[model samples]
Target: MATPVRVTRLCRLVGRTVSSPSARHRQAVSLPARTCFISTTTWKNLLFKLDERTAHSSLDLFKKDTGVIYRMLGLDPTHVQDNPERFRDWAVVFGNERISSGRHYWEVTIKKSQEFRLGVAEAAMSRDDCVGTNRCSWVFSYAQRKWFAMTNGKTVPVTLVGKPDRVGILLDYEAGLLGLVDIENPRIIHAFKAQFKAPLCPAFGLWDGELLTHSGLEEPEGLK
Candidate 1:
């Protein structure tokens, strides 16, 4: 098992939360979980897992998939600006997958994005609040050429040896751990130790560029 790494020296960032959700917002929240998947030749690969043999033998673990790819579609592009479920005035969205047990791993390709936040948040987290700015979520964010680990309005600066193009996320629900990895550089960015009390969905907040998700991945050897 991978050991949990605790984030330290956190300082509070200014934030706000909405106590009550509107009826339309509540309705949108009730929509069934939607996951995006693309196929090449075979398989209905919305989400995937590796077979024992391939998983045990692979060195290029992140790129090698079992003929399937899972993607995350953020929101209705036409209605994104007016979307009631958007996080306050920000462009934030959550993936449909709700994780409550065992271990899970996924990656997000940050394509030309100048500012973005990626991580997990409780399904019931307030849409009016930003991810990692409250107790219900945890995230690793990049803005203005700086990196941070944030939760509950607290932010911790992250020092990285190399820039990240693709980020790896590892969630061990039972262990109450959330780890963020820098894939290109093969190093851990930060890990938040928490007593997760509810099911979590992949949460993201983006400003300028695209965020592509690659799911159904095995935990990286370095994380182990």
Candidate 2:
């Protein structure tokens, strides 16, 4: 059976602080390229910024809990009630940038890693849905001392050599691949391949503990 997931939690509480945002809903940052690449096993050097889409109305609880005055004040209560993008049963944040082409690399460090999910989702991914449960998203999740690669409502168990403090994500957009790496041990935990159809946003879900993002980084030399 596919592992049932609840996209809810403390609601995306950890990330670098940003300036107070406007009341209007924020959109994904546009990418410069649209051409996909031919599939290749060789990785390329890439760097990209990764910032949380902090204006989300669904993250009010997180703001309140963390006492981030800026975010608390920035909450659009009106939008919370009617915003089509507001998540009713789940809480996650997407990166401000979108990926439509080229290769991209980033890593997330898990602090008190109890239960968290990280991966990519199309910009149009349903606010009411969970990542990896639909065609529009793919993820690597760790929960209950177990790890799995999930997408399209299917789950594949991932066996690791040891607990990893950081997980690396490699997205080959045109080549259609998503890989999760065990940074400490320098090994791939799992990878998913597909013909990506739309621009993707970095997506994260956390219930307890923190997931810190490290972006605009060199692709790990060991993974090359």
Candidate 3:
């Protein structure tokens, strides 16, 4: 019989910090790239900005204790609700618009938390299915002092020289490409080639008491 996996809510106490360079480096340095074809030139040419208005109303919080009050950044106050029973395993939120074609880009700022998962998911994906576990989602997750791409229940470890404070995502649905970029240096952290069958919504996942803020769209310096 397959080993049973225990599921727990994605909640944690607020105000914890993950800023030790030694810790970040120790976690990310040993992972190997899942995809080996990333090029810096390609990333610069495809730069696109995030559409902040599309930020999701609900996000999964990664806390273990019940009755813990936490803030959901980028969500409207009226839509926020308290649900102690709903926190479990993974917390996810979706971008408002769907990407059916063309190249689009967005950026997210990681302020307080050290670990997170971000990528694109099919609009029809089940709420119960965490991003990167199924064919419908293409996710890049950072946790346990490592970075990796998750898809079809498999992990492709990614290596990076430094931890990124801001992350940029590029979805070239027409070309079947998805990329993760480090916004400060503007370098490609990882990229994937997949056959995306349905319209994709930008997705976010939070665990480990991290705070993520959506930095609205900004035209690439030369694109405007």
Candidate 4:
């Protein structure tokens, strides 16, 4: 979904994504507005320095196997993952910044996207979101602790919507723009903000019209 041309085009037109992020693109490379401030030293973190190393690592992810990642579109996983060129169009809006107010920039993005088209769900936590609209998406059920991804369209960006440094991850199904948390037991769909868990099944495919079936989706087979 992300290409160098696309990333640049979106960055130029869409501008910043996260409603409120620690590190932000400023008109003047000085500091963010006071209302955008979190603390006195917040500027230090907000104004994150995008060094070559950090930039390199983010790019590396696109090349690495990252078995945990699953690209539903392209029909093949290698099309996105293991292919750095695919992500060139994407810009690291937030490399690693702390948001004292919102649920980190990633979470903020998840929330915003969810509100715009979809929503987040987690039983323990009220609700969380990550990743936004994708070219496509296909929802499915979790059966184990294995990482997962899906699509409802031709392609959708699946992003990890967890805090900068925390476990208990979930996928922001951009195609569907839905925040889906993996139920510890794999058979529960946790509500994003309700912090409540509901019993689900491993074969619980997304609702298809008035019917429930795994019709147009495939399992997250990870890297080749």
**Residues forming the 10-long window of minimal summed lDDT in candidate 3:** 61-70
**lDDT to native, each model:** 0.59, 0.62, 0.55, 0.21
Among all windows of 10 consecutive residues in model 4, the one with the lowest summed lDDT is 200-209
Q: After superposing candidate 1, which stretches have Cα over 4 Å from the reference?
A: 1-88
- The full ranking of all candidates by TM-score, starting with the best, is 2, 1, 3, 4
Number of the candidate with higher TM-score, 1 or 4? 1
TM-score of 3: 0.60
- Candidate 1 backbone overlaps, count: 0
Expressed as tens digits, the lDDT of each residue in 1-224 for candidate 3 is 12323223232322222222342342211122223222334443332222222222334333221111134443443454423212122455555455666676777666555667789887656544567766788888777676777776667778876566777787778789888877776666688889988767777666545544443355243320
**lDDT of model 4 at residue 165?**
16
Quantify how close model 2 is to the true structure by its C-alpha RMSD in Å.
8.3
lDDT of 4 by residue, 1-224 (tens): 32211211111112112233233331112222223322325532122211121111122222121101111121222223332111222221112222232121111111111111122221111101112212211232221212233322222233433421111222322221223433233321332212212211011111111111111122222311
lDDT for each residue of candidate 1 in 175-201, tens digit (9 for 90 to 100): 888888877656666788899887777
Question: Model 1: how far is 28 from its true place, Å?
Answer: 13
Off by over 4 Å in 3: 1-89, 215-224
Better of 1 and 3 by TM-score: 1
Considering every candidate listed, which one attains the maximal TM-score? 2
TM-score to native of every candidate shown: 0.64, 0.67, 0.60, 0.19
